[model samples]
Target: MTAQATTSEPAASEPARRKTAIPKNPGRRDLGLRATLLFPNREIVERYYVPVIYTACRTCYSEQDPDEIFRRALAGDFDSLKMQKLIGSVIESGHGSTIEHVVFTFAISGVSRTLSHQLVRHRAGVAFDQQSQRYVKFKGAATMLPHSIAEGDPDLRTRYEEQVDGALGLYGDMLQAGVPGEDARFIFPNATRTNLVMTANLRALIHMSGLRLCTMAQWEIRRLFQLIRHEIFSVSPFLGSFLAPKCVPLGYCDEFNNRDGHCPIRPHKDRVLEAWAEKAAAARAAGRELPVT
Candidate 1:
C-alpha cells in the first residue's frame, strides 16, 4: 500500500502568528467592482485640472485678479513645473480650498450595498447619485460573494448561495404579485450589488482615499478605493500620488486597533510617543530640555 500524508494543526501551546498588513493590489481578480473616470479624461485633466488648481492657489497670494490668473494659466503662460511645485506645497500645507476648484467624477458599479453604505458617509466636497432600488425593479439582481464564504467549506458556500438566491427569488415573487418595488426591496441583502456616480473635489478625494486605503478599512471598500486610485492614476500620476493610506503621510498609524503594531506599514502612534518620551527622558538626564510639539 502507498504511504499517505496527513495534515496536523499547530500545537496548542504555540502562539498564534501576528497578522501583518498586506497592501492590496487591485486588478488581481475580477471582483466585479468597477470604477471608471466618467468625466475629465487625460487631455481635459492635463489642460484644465492643474491650471484650475494653480489658479486657485495663485489667486490667494498674487495681487492679480483671479480671472487674469486663470486666463494666464489656461493660456500656458505659467511654467507647468512651477505650477505643480506650488500646488504640491500648498496641498502639503493643508490649504485644502485651493485644490477644491477641480473635481473628478467616477461611475462606480458592481460594488456591494455594504460598500456603498460606507462610501456615502463621506459628505464634504463630494456628491453621490446611486441607482434607486425603489424606482427601478431588478429583474435579476446579482449579489456579491465574499472571498471567505466563497472559499470556505463547499457545503457552507452552497448554503450561502442558496440563501442569497432565495431572497432574490422571494423579491421577484413579491413583484409578480403586484407588490411595490420599494416594499419588495426590503428582502434585498447587504450583499446585493449597487451602482453609484460620485463626484468629489481633489481635497475630498485625498481625504477619503487616506481613510479608505488604510489596512483597517473594510476589504471591499478598500478594494473600491484601489480601483478609484487606479482610475485617477490613469489620468494624472501627480494627483494620484496623493491618494494613499492615512499613515503614509501621517508617519504613524493612529488606528486604535493598531496598538499591538500588527500593521507593519507604520509604527503605531503609541510607539512613536513612547520613543519620544524615551528621548525626552534621556535629555532630562543630561540636564537639557527637548522641544515638544
Candidate 2:
C-alpha cells in the first residue's frame, strides 16, 4: 500500500518535457587551419622585405644615392629598429608604397567555407586560388557543424543535423538531375568547407591582419591569422614579426570599440592624446619645454 501511494503522487502536476533525441561530444573537432610559406620562400624574404624597408628608411637620412643605399641595406649595415621606426611613421602617414615591395604567400587550409566566402571579398592587394567546387564531384562531400550546434540542446541539435543532412541530399539530387556542379553548389551551406592558397605583399598582409586579427573579426578567420602568424614566425621571426594586431606596433590602440580604453595592448589614441595634453600643461606650469616626437 505504501509503494502504490508513493508512486501515484502527482503525474498531472509534473510539466511535460520533451525527450532528447541525440547526445553530444562523440569526439574532438578540429579547426583544421594550416599555414606555410607557399612562395618567395625564406631566402626571398631574408633578401627582400628587410632590405626594401631598409632602403625606404635610409633614403630619408642618406646623402648617398638611393641605389647605393639599397646595396648596403641589402648587404646589412644599420640597425633594423631605426629603419622600422621610419617605416612605421611612413605607414601611419599613409605612405604605404614603401612597404609594398615585399610579399608573403601562405597555404591556408581546412578553414570553413563560411570564412573563405568573407575572406575572398577583399577586393584589392590580395590573390587566392581556392579548391574548386565546380569541377570536383562529391564522392563524399564533407561538412562542418559548429560546436554550439554540435553540443547543443537536443531538439536544436536534431534540427541542425536535419538541415545539414537535407542540404547534402539535395545537392546529390541536383547533380543526378544533370545540373551543373556550380549551380548545384547553390545548395551547399557555409558549413561545407574548403581550402585555399593566398599571396599578398607585406603592405596588404599588414592591412588584412590588422582588421582580421582584431577582436571584431569573426572567430574562425581570427584563428586562421593565428595559424598564419605561427607559420610566418617559423620562417622568419624578424619579418613574421610585423604581422600583428595593429595595436602591437602602434603603441596605442585605434579600435573604435576600444575607445573606453580597455584592451591594454596599447593606450587608446584618445587616452594618449589626453595624457599628452596634461603633460603639456604641467610643462607650462613648470616653465619647462615639452619634447615632441
Candidate 3:
C-alpha cells in the first residue's frame, strides 16, 4: 500500500522555471565559438579529393574499372567543369555516400560546455577528443556570459557575474584545501568554457550543418556553424555551398517548434500542406483531380 503523507510534512518547494526566450533580434556580440578547419587545404582538395569522390560516384554506373576511372579523373582527362557538374548533380540528388570519401578536421575552442554537450551528440561518421576536466586542473577557468544576461538590467548582470565568480572562488578554496580536482569540478557551471578537436566526413559535416545552421537553432550553436561554413568556403566554395539549413534544400520548415512561424526563414510544412488541401478541395469542387507529384 502507498504511504499517506503526514499532515506535518513540509511541502516541497519548486523553483520557478525560466521561460526560454529566443532572441528575435540578438545584438551581434563576438560569441567565442571558434571552428578552425585543420585539414584538406586548397592544394589537398585540388589534388586527389574530387577524383576520389568522382570514382565513388561513377563506379556504380560505368562499365569502366574503378582504378581506370580514378586515373582519368586525377589526370584531368575529363573537363574540370564537367566533372564538377556531375558531382554537384549527384550530391543534389541525395547520393550522400559519394561525398563521404572526403573528410575535414577542425580545432574548436572557447565554446561553453553547454554547446560542447550538444556537439558531442552527433555520433555517426564524426570523432571528438575534448579537453579533460578531470585531468586538467584549471588555474583561471573562464566562463561564457550569454548575450541576454550581459545585456539585461545592470543589476541582474552584476548579480550573475558575482554568482559565477563566487563559485569559482569556492572551487579555488577547495583545491587549496587539498580537495581532488574531479570532486571540485562539480561546482563548475554549464557556462564554463571548453575546447575540443572534431573530425567528420563531408557527409556528416553537411548533415550537422543542415541542423545547426537553421534560424531556429540555439544562437551560439548557429554561430558556430556559420564559422564552420566560412572555413569550408575558404578551402572550397563548391563544397561549402552544400552546407546550409535543411529547410533551404527542402523549401519548407519542418521543425515542430516552428509551426507558429516565429522564425521566418521558410514557410511551415503544415501551412504548405494546408494550402495544398485547400487547392485540392477547390479542384474537387470543379469536378477535377489536383495533380500530384
TM-score, each model?
Answer: 0.90, 0.74, 0.89
Model 1, 1-293: lDDT tens digits are 10111224458998975544564432245677789999989999999999899988998899999999989999999999999999999998889999888899999998889999999999999999999999999988978887667656989878878888899999999999999999999999999998999999989999999999998888789989999999999999999999999999889999998798877899999999999999999999999999867
In model 3, which range of ten residues has the least summed lDDT?
A: 1-10
Give the range of the ten consecutive residues with the poorest summed lDDT in model 1.
1-10
Tens-place lDDT per residue, model 3, 1-293, is: 11111122224785654444334322244675579999978889888888888899889899999999999998889888788888888988999999988999999988889999999999989999999989988888888888667767989878888888888888889999999999999999888889999999999999999999887778778878888999999988888998999898889999998998877778899999999999999999999999887
Better of 2 and 3 by lDDT: 3
TM-score, candidate number 1: 0.90
**Candidate 2 residue spans exceeding 4 A from truth:** 1-29, 60-63, 77-94, 250-293
- Which residue pairs clash within candidate 3? none
Per-residue lDDT for 261 in model 2? 59
Indicate the TM-score of model 3.
Answer: 0.89
Residue pairs in collision within model 2: none
lDDT of 2 by residue, 60-127 (tens): 77798888888877777766667667776777777777777777788887667898998898866889
Model 3: how far is 67 from its true place, Å? 1.7
Residue 85, candidate 2: C-alpha displacement in angstroms? 5.4
For model 2, the local distance difference test gives: 0.73
The best candidate by lDDT is 1
